[model samples]
Target: MDSVSEAQFELDQLRHQARKQLLGTVVLGVMAGLLAFVGQSALGQARPLLESSFGTWQSLYTVVLWALAIAWLVALIQQALHYQNISEQFESRRRLDAVYAERAAKAQAVEEERQRQRAESEARQAAERNRRLNKNSHSTKFDFWQE
Candidate 1:
């Protein structure tokens, strides 16, 4: 379509993309939290079963838990960074949209002012024409009366 419509479409797309990114970041964060919780719960439950098998399984379990915790922390940090990036993008888009809206408002105001001036000019012209017509008619009537 027109440039205005295209710009609007692009703005809408940006908004949608930002929203999706935010949602994905939230989902990732939630998943990471859930994973940590579940891991802890499972480890606690399995501790009883491993009591008899102690040493070997205990070391393995500790290593595994530490690895998972490290991984979860990393993932959480990554997701937080991604969310911040999305927020920055969203803010940028909003600023752009605000600029566009301000420009549009100024353009509309200029157009309206021009239209008002044009209408006033036309009215003045019409009034001047009417005055001239009245003067001519009065002159003709006076000449006829003198005859």
Candidate 2:
């Protein structure tokens, strides 16, 4: 495919991937919250185990989640900017095409008008020449037959 089609395809893929990531992130966030709630209340006997695990890993897990979230945000921003650039390029190209088309039409109209004026001038000159020739012929020996 052409470059335009390729870029469009890539944009579409990115859009789909972004959507999936967003949904997955939301669902995972909800599940994590629910798990935390259940563990805090319903599983009292497991508090020591959970607390130890949390103490050992919660900070690290939080950092990792934040990093992933930031990366996703950056990807989304890049995608939006890229899409905007492509849209601007298309808009400028359309405007340029319109300007070129208008110029061509104007040139064609001017050329046609010029040709019409030239034709009219030539016709008037031919008529004037014929009139002179007829007048001169009548006053010359060429008119003997008429006399």
Candidate 3:
């Protein structure tokens, strides 16, 4: 509705988004680690099975291992980049929140000053009215005696 509420709502949304991004990054990292471990285990088990054949099979097995290693490296790099992006997003949100807080504080201070000035103006007006009333009443009393 108002600017303050709107700012607060936006800040909340940013926080939610940042949390979600963090969770996603963690999940990605875990998945990458699992993939590497599983791939390594599978290759280790397969090596003995092909050992009897040797020669050509050994070359193929080496190629397969290298490919898997490369894939794992790529996955790790991708996850790291995703995490970096998320970190940047968090930083941006933090800066935005700081700006919002500063603006809110300034707005509150301005509103308080405005209220104080208004109260002082009202007090001055009330005092002026009372002074005029007293002067008129004293003059009227003298007039009553003359009549």
In candidate 1, the residue pairs with backbone N, CA or C atoms under 3 Å apart (3 or more residues apart, or in different chains) clash, namely none
lDDT of 3 by residue, 1-147 (tens): 656556556666666666666667667657766776686667667777867665576567567767866766676566666666666666666677788889989999999999999999999999999999987777654686787
lDDT for each of the candidates? Answer: 0.73, 0.67, 0.71
List ranges where model 1 is wrong by over 4 Å. Answer: 1-53, 140-147
- Report the C-alpha displacement of residue 35, candidate 3, in angstroms: 11
- The full ranking of all candidates by TM-score, starting with the best, is 3, 1, 2
Candidate 3 Cα errors over 4 Å, as ranges:
1-52, 140-142, 145-147
Q: How badly does each model clash, as a count of residue pairs?
A: 0, 0, 0
Residues 1-147 of candidate 2: C-alpha lDDT, one tens digit per residue: 645555556666665665666566666666656666574454456556778676446555556657766766666566666656666655565566667668979999999999999999999999999999987766666666776
Against the true structure, what is each candidate's TM-score? 0.64, 0.57, 0.65
Question: Which candidate, 1 or 3, has the higher lDDT?
Answer: 1
At residue 141, candidate 2 shows an lDDT of 62
> How does model 2 fare in lDDT?
0.67
TM-score, structure 3 vs. true: 0.65
Flag regions of model 2 displaced more than 4 Å.
1-51, 136-142, 145-147
lDDT by residue for model 1 (51-147), tens: 7775677577668767866876676676667656666665676677778889989999999999999999999999999999987777554596687
